[model samples]
Target: MVHHRPRTRERCPLWARRARASTPLRTLLLGLLLTLAAGPISMGATDGGGIGGTGITGFGPIQGFGSIFVNAREYFLRADTRITVDGRAAGRRALHVGDMVVVRGTADPARTTGWADVVQVRHPLVGRVDAVSAGGAHLTVLGQGVRIPAGVPVVGGDGHTVALHAGDWVAVSALANARDEWIATRVALRYPAGSVPAGVPAVIEGRVASVGPNGVLRIGTQAVRLEGAAAHKSAPAPGARIRVVGRYRDGVILASRLAPARPALGGPGRYVEMEGYAVPRAAGGLHSNGILLRPPGGKEGAGPTGIRADRALVFTGRIGPDGSLEIERMEPPHAPELPHAGAGGGERGFGGHGTHGIERPELERPRIERPELEQPRIERPEIGRPRIERPEIVRPEIEIPQAQRPEIPEVEMPGH
Candidate 1:
């Protein structure tokens, strides 16, 4: 009787054997990695693409000036770049460091710098200084209360801080707090108490309190008569923020222009950078002004995670269809750089135009570019890890002779 010898199973290779044991787990981990990588991109997060073609709009304080820096990025101003300050045409000489501005332009892929097509600076409060506190820390303008905290600069046309007194025709650059209170960034003396320049248009921004027939709009205690094209157009709805530009006569503003105070940055799918303070949200994520910012997944708050809620930050992201900003990255804003006096006699300081000693009002023009001054470096504090200590483990001693120990068989366990 001939019987075939039993064939033994061939041993698999070491690498193959190990891979076989964890194949399912590895596949699961790979799938998780892919999902995480695609989260932001799928949510319309910009990869910083479209260097010259993509439009970028941002709102932030002017950090410095080569052309101008906003939201930590330098924006190169053009010769015809339309600039407006409080609904009036302005030049680069009108821009100041630390002034909050809105820039609409196109940036490179890195988003570090770009070309500015339009720059707008809007002062929240522009009217006669109603009352100044005894300590000069608080004031009221146009019935709106304003608070001046320590270190908040009160700048004049000469770039020096001036004492604020009652009945001064001043313009206040400020940010409204959550309580709708104005916190002054800077108080500018536009004109002396009774020396306001004639032909300087009177501008006021406020919510529309009421509307009357024949193009009459009331804001607070002030009444505005919208004329010309502004009157012919549809009147702004009540509660809408409106900016009126015209002259004041008999306690009423004869408005030649009426526009929205805060214009929307861009439409859906537009990339935008915004700088604002973070406030915790009830649902999740954080709130900057009225803009909602969330991480890629929207599962958690994007801020207070390596970011302080009290501090301001520049958020880089895209505008969602619902007007929310899906935050892709965020960084602390660059500190405001104070302009230094140039060495020449006629040359102005670094912030404004340097006319080289000639004083001509007609010659005053917007600066397309300027030499970049050395800005003081800001060093970040280093974080160190704490050392951990583990308790020592001591084994009990059992004196046993090695030769008298019992023999045990070795067992090979299969990999899981």
Candidate 2:
């Protein structure tokens, strides 16, 4: 069988100026050269290179070389030596499958099978797209601009149309053109859904059925609390309508403004219609916790906040003995009988005992008794007795002598 001889290896010239060229172009040239140089050397080879005398075929494993195969003529490769494909210099040509190649080596004559060393193979140029620019459709390939042709389809991350303007990010793929730019075959955009709705502020409306210790409102299947200092007026009654303005989260709605249905009136025990979930109390009664009931027509009120009732609303089947009203069933509001005292005249107010008014009697004073005193009389002695005592008196005598003397004198005178 006739065989073509393998060519000798040739040295390639290397220069620093080649390395300084743009990155993409340099890579392309390097790949092309390698492909051409290796292509022909692989094609011209006739048999496996000669470690053994057996002829190498496409079937089974070939020995002594990295790879081997049979061509139309006799075995071409006989020994191990580096060679080139076609007439291209070694290390300067690109190689690929099905390209003509030639290998040069010492042929073994004594062996019954022909063999030669595989030195190279041939290759062809394939196009590729590298990168896209910011806010521009132009692409950089092999370090050059590649304008994208029109009518090329652009897809998003979800494989839909890439509807975006400038500054939107995307990925692109295409064919490389003469100017080193890629002719975009496809483009894809990426973004997130569920972003905040534009222009409209969030508003909620519902009835305030119950007020928590922290001032959260129990609406239908939702709890409305305030995040900031909310201007809250009289609380909405169990059946009264309310409007709220604030943020919504999880099953809880936060209120920035809590306003009752009517601004003109305020009192206790008002009935407000509300929708919410019935939370069973641990002590055996049902308490409605979170209620989500929005007002009609979505109108703004005096700083009122609430939840929408369009979604699911939960109700507890029975009200417990703890004075908490349980939802037996959820239906449109009807005329409800006001709670009153029972037939036995039981207490009227919620959880209040019966009423019976009667005054108590006054205390009496104590009485004391005194003992009587007797009078004593003494007897007087009766006696009438005359006892006379004689009086004793002593008289003096004097006048007889004087009379005698006077008579004597008269007689003497008469005598004279």
Candidate 2 local lDDT, 1-416, one digit each (tens): 99989997565575345357788888888888898888754433233334433222111001112123212112343233355532234532222112223332322323323444443432111111234555445644222243444434455444445544433333343222212223443444432223322321223333446776666666533466765657345456565445455544443556666554221111222112222222333333222322212222222221112312222122212222322223333442111111231333222111121211111112234565655656566677777787899888778876765444344443445655
Error of 2 at 385 (Å): 99
**lDDT (Cα, tens digit) per residue for candidate 1, span 318-354:** 8776677878888765442223524443211111222
Best by TM-score: 1
Model 1 quality (TM-score): 0.58
Best by lDDT: 1
In angstroms, the error of model 1 at 166 is 2.6
Give the C-alpha miss distance for residue 371 in model 2, angstroms. 99
Q: lDDT scores for all predictions?
A: 0.68, 0.35
After aligning candidate 1 to the native by TM-score, how far in Å is the CA of 52 from where it should be? 3.3
